[model samples]
Target chain A: MNGVKSESVREPLILGNPSLGDVSDKIAGIIESPPTKKFWALVTITSIIALQGLCSVAYTVWVGPGVWGVNNPVGWGWAITNFVWWIGIGHAGTLISAILFLFRQKWRTAINRSAEAMTIFAVMCAGLFPLLHTGRQWIAAYWLLPYPNQMQMWTNFRSPLEWDVFAVSTYFTVSLVFWYTGLVPDFATMRNRIKNVLGRNLFSFFSLGWTGSTRNWAHYEMAYLILAGLSTPLVLSVHSIVSFDFAVSVIPGWHTTIFPPYFVAGAIFSGFAMVMTLLIIARWVLNLHDFITLKHLDNMNKIMLATGMMVGYAYAMEFFIAAYSENPYEQYVFLNRAFGDYAWAYWSMVSCNVLVPQIFWFKKLRRSIPAMFVASLLINVGMWFERFVIIATSLHNDFIPGSWDYYSPSWVEVSIYVGTMGIFLTLFLLFAKFVPMLAISEVKGVMPGAQPKHDHH
Target chain B: MEEQTLTQPVKSESAETEASAHMEQPDARATSDPLAVMGDFVDPNEVTDAARAIHAAGYTDFDIYTPYPVHGLEKAMGMKKTILPFFSLGGALFGLGNAIFLQWWTGTLHYPLNIGGKPFFSPWFGMPVMFELTVLLCALTTAVVMFGLLCKLPQWHNPFQKDAGFRRAVDDTFVVVIEAKDQRFTVDSATNLLEKLGASNVRLVNV
Candidate 1:
């Protein structure tokens, strides 16, 4: 009995020794309390930014793809770059919720609800770039899907682009359902506690009459385990298919077998950085430092550090493979990436993706709020440039020098990217306000004395 | 913290229903009354004990409820393992079959075009779509079947909701409810048994 107790015992996931009711009151109270002045200010700012991004999308649809800076050789410019970056940003959420949950990372319960929300919002932002880039947005459905139309043409199953349609759409749908399944119990808690009639009715409808019965929990736990199992593979597959978009192409820099794993690492790295950036501000503003503890921040920073090294290793491997292949086209692409016109972007990627996270080796910096907050921002910037360096640098200089030209985003392109940020933040803010940002039920489950005591022989 | 005082059993104020099933009379009460005796428990260990005691007393229709899933309580109540994984497997097979048919038929038979001299139908290229669809279908089936069919959730009018004390189950308290429909169930015996086994705020409410 003593041995078993010693093995299982550890620092509590939640701090201040909160009781189960305190856990409910602390989380649900965020939603019940009237909106604070700071909350309104942030909402106003993000909503305005989101509106601007929506307008940019509308303008692009009205004006055509010519409004952006994509030319003959550099056709896949900021739009594709932003699409990949946004999608990569979403990977952290699933990594935390599905992957970490399977590994029995008890600390994830504090932040998984919000991280999954961020994942859905990030994917929504990611989808906008691809949808708007289609030029004729109205007819995109026909082009993307294998639906039977009067044209009698089937979407090319062999094409990686066709694979992307299934990969991303399936990813979004599955993530949404997985997130909602976790939310149902939390919603039931809201249903029982909220004072207002309208809020109560809404929670009642969404909660699905969850009574927390052990019989029902038996089924609910099974369903949750199954979803997490499915999402683990689905998350890896989504980004691999995204990588297939570039890898399947015959372009010198793009055609590499290493793209899938490399892209996945970079996605997790950037996604964690974004999560850290948002979480730091959220914990501070919401006064949830006890729940979103320094330990959680330290764990996240370590992940960013590990994934950052994977990305750095992939970057070096790409160069070595380019030189070893005895192919001048590949060699030139790598050389041009580092030494030619877009050297600034390449170096930025290296510094941010490779160099910046090295600061986390110091335990103090990893746990320090200001140090991590700034590092998270720089890492995301580095990731964005990493995508741009991959896309624009490869496309800008072609086989023949005659077709070579510089690529830069037009105002519309720049605004659209910024607008997506606005849209993402606005949705996150709304979610933080209206929903229990912490998984209330889950957080309670991991608290000290949460489980029934058992005597071991 | 005042709510955690469990030294004495606090009988519910609104036990307006007839308490006809006292220890003196072990027989059935009037059939008109649909009584579900609920006991509010402060600790999970105590709830497990009460559930074990109630189950051992030959009552088959009883449940334990808590704010979150209590690990041993399901075993203490003797719940059968759910078959949700089987449904998930069925969904995966269906998705895999559909994806194979769609790709094979469309690529080879429906409209075959020679692009870059690649084969019309190769499983290598088709794997991504197949994997995505399989996961998507499996996830959907698990969620829908678990909530809608197996658990019978989204039931806004659950009989337990009529008892106001039941609200604490989702908040802090662990609850055990022995349905009045149980053959061995009597309101007085259920209430007396719960109070005897260290449950606080015992009450019988018509559901």
Candidate 2:
């Protein structure tokens, strides 16, 4: 059986058998070195794209949500689709950092930093959509927050949209702190290494006088553990809350008890794909193959495969439940998703997400870098379409055929979506250039013979 | 090296007598005086062993510093479990209570309006916000309590920063520092003790 030989089949996570010093040098060297031509080229392109996104957003705000193709029935269009897509991409980072850490997965150490950075950046992009979508951000933003005023008006806490406000903001804040806490020790390392005044001062300020003392380590470990515990539920809850924006509604396809878990699974599935897309390029561009090795990619591919299957199962279950219940509305929604106006989006999602990831079930394909990269890109496209289909198809034709209209995104809406990619890439490029993209101290901890042998009395 | 080891006991004994004399006038050295005798070890194992030895030698106020958290070193150094969990729990409870009160106050008490015949406040509807706030506050409190209270962070200036050897504590070296204010501390005795415990470079750091 495939299970019988599992123990012998597993590969060493860090390839090339690099030493701790070598690992630190290779990873830190990327930050210390002058930016390469390719690095500059990538950054410039991404920056230009980010600029385009900014322009699109400015245009949208200066005009109105009318710039989008959203109409009466399809009120939530590209903005909500992109918002959910970006938020879902953000999930993989917390999953890798917090959930995997809780499970004691050591491979996460290689990618957690970059993934968390992606999470922060992706969430930043995701947060912009709802604000811009409001059409009057200045007033809507303040109105969203629960602040005391002379009128005694407060944000409706009973609404899932309000829950989104709190959930997303809290998720962002906690993720930031969690990310920074992990950075402290490495910042201390950088502070110690730098010779110049500016570098030393900047790093020292951020490092927070971390001496790596046993007492500090004791407390630091506890804090990390606690944050991990807190963030694990948060990663799940954030997406579940995002799902609540739909599930709590009485829309035909939107209302379901399975939405929370299914959304969470889809979030992680998409998130891992995005992480793979960025990291595959990064590991090659930055020459960090020794640290972010084939083993790491293989393991990540395995996760994508698993989660992708979970999503596919959820997709099938939705249809099964719809048909089994004999509810005409729910049944119609599923039928519309499959064979109606937005059927192209639905089939693309199914083929790319459900079918393509199955290639990873073969051990050979999972380990192949090029194959995995292509699959990752496909999965990302699939996941985006999954969101688009859910939002557009479900909302497009409700109960009345008289109100039905074919929805198509305007240029502004399309530009904004593409612009988010630019924003995500630009931030990622900056992070790769400036930050220690791998966990140096953590990798050191996992080195052979790194742990001290105690003489038990 | 053998001669150095042989001559250490005499020096340690004399320092012990001097330390005993100083112990009688402990407050004579003001509280503002420098705190610790710091030593650097090239090997993590050596520092871990030294931490155990120093703990066994009855010195309570001491610490080991390393680039990464050394497994089992907490137990070896006899560090007590942290109270961060309690702080997190306290924060969570506060956040949950605050969320419920705010929801109840805003929806039911302050300016309530009926929507879709739903109740003014539903606990199920409020669960998402409550859960988010609970996790948010719990994580924030844990981080604040850990970095601010326990670790005493944001003090960018530390006496150990002046020592180039101590800087390696954040890189590849391991360091052990026994506070000068400890009952058994004297410069000579602490130096001898650290040297005997395989410390490579031992020095007294003044803040």
Candidate 3:
């Protein structure tokens, strides 16, 4: 098969020459049968990790945000950093499902379902941070909304935080609907394939009595198209609004017009990396080489390479603009980022996000599973540090020299970050075991000779 | 066994004559309270051809079911375009207006506070939320409206679900069902048409 060029040629997405029956049977089998020992082992580990995160959140809520690390100089620390990191990781799913779909990328059909699931779960993980960041989350959560109150107090509509409330929540709702709508027909397939009454009933309920009627298919296809159309902008707008949370500020390092596009490109960059990390393992574990082929992995790595470069350019531009603008504070911030106390993080971000992904420029390394996996893991690390650098470095060293106190994350902050990973992995593991990780009907659509020939007349 | 016999070519002169003859007389035997006459086809191509023949013969109350969506099957079935887009548009407009009005009312009128000397109701600042709410409502309305109003889903107990051949509709079979309630439906005529159009099995199902 041809590699990662956007030429007008049809490559067989499903390799190994599997028939339609074999495709359905193999994918649906994972969900139908009992979980394997490895599946149980992975689930158990992720569950424990998730439980740790839950406990960390509980302790943070119990004591206050002080349990973590946040002082006068650096108000936003690891919590916000992890929030941005997780949110960025969620971007790839929508990009794969909506953007690539609009571009007619058939390679996406093999991976979109799991990617969408990853988006939802990652958003769920990301949502936990903002809530936990608020010391009194119970009250602070409701206070974020603009519901009428006895005191007639309303949330400031001018605040980017309020805009964020609408943006992220709308994003979650749209992603969930888009994900479930795609699942309906596949759920019907499961309902017919499974033998257990309970399993059949559950699938049937979700399937909504889908008969695959031509009329139902017609409407279903239209609704799906409209949703994809709507989600494309919604996905871009989500990260843009997230960037607004930083760009709207007047702080020397935070206030920049390029934050929106920079953050979006970074989000997709980290998202594709995370998808690669997960799919690489999943392809091996689930024996999905025929579906999630090396071709798919190569294409994803190329995206990581491109977006990583875009992020790298953003990094360079920020420095260039900082020096060119001749703003002392901005120059100081840039200098401090490179040679300051947080220089370790700055260099790490540079090496991981920018330098490491450059290896994918070679065709062999791009196709190498181990190299791609390592690069993806490093990219995730780099992306997380990228957020940390953006949030902590800028905040730690303010304009006034008196307030330049170094900040370090306490154990609580570290645990919460690790716990979010647990939550993400746990949800993903369950999704892999239960839901058809591959979109069966879509895979069929891309299979060779699946479509019937129609007369032009 | 019965499917083999049903696939035999009808021993008649022309499809038009047979269809008109069936339409002229509503046979009592054919109208004996049968729920529907269902035909199963192995290939989607055959189903598409059968759908064309059935539609051309002027059967309006027929439906085609398949394992996966068959392209061009809707055109062959002569189905009309759905009204779901209008619902989505309406929802989007409502959401946009509501967001604008709510943000304006809250930021400007209800409990306005001048922060950093910025305007109370900045439409520029509110654009993201407005855009988000519009997309949110549009997506949700499209899903609910299509599933609830158009597809009329959650129909857990459709009579066709009991048919053995119908089970394969979600697996590897294509089926066409013509309701007996149609003005021009007769058992022999429907079964003969389905067979002539290349159906593998034609069975009459009770509601």
Best by DockQ: 1
- For candidate 2 chain A, the 10 contiguous residues with the lowest summed lDDT are A1-10
Off by over 4 Å in 3: A1-9, B1-33
Candidate 3 C-alpha lDDT tens digits along A81-110:
988999999999999999999898989999
Error of 2 at B82 (Å): 0.8
| C-alpha RMSD by candidate, in order | 4.6, 6.5, 6.2
Report the Cα lDDT for residue B47, model 3: 70
* Clash number for each model: 1, 0, 0
- lDDT of each residue in B20-139, candidate 3, tens digit only: 342234334543367888777756566777788899999998998776778888988998887788999999998999899988998887788888898998789889888988998899
Order the candidate numbers by DockQ, best to worst.
1, 2, 3
Lowest lDDT 10-residue stretch of candidate 3 chain A: A1-10
Q: Each prediction's Cα lDDT score?
A: 0.88, 0.85, 0.86
Interface RMSD of each: 2.6, 5.1, 3.8
Q: Using lDDT as the measure, what is the rank order of every candidate, best first?
A: 1, 3, 2
Model 2: clashing residue pairs?
A: none
Q: Return the candidate ranking by TM-score, descending.
A: 1, 3, 2
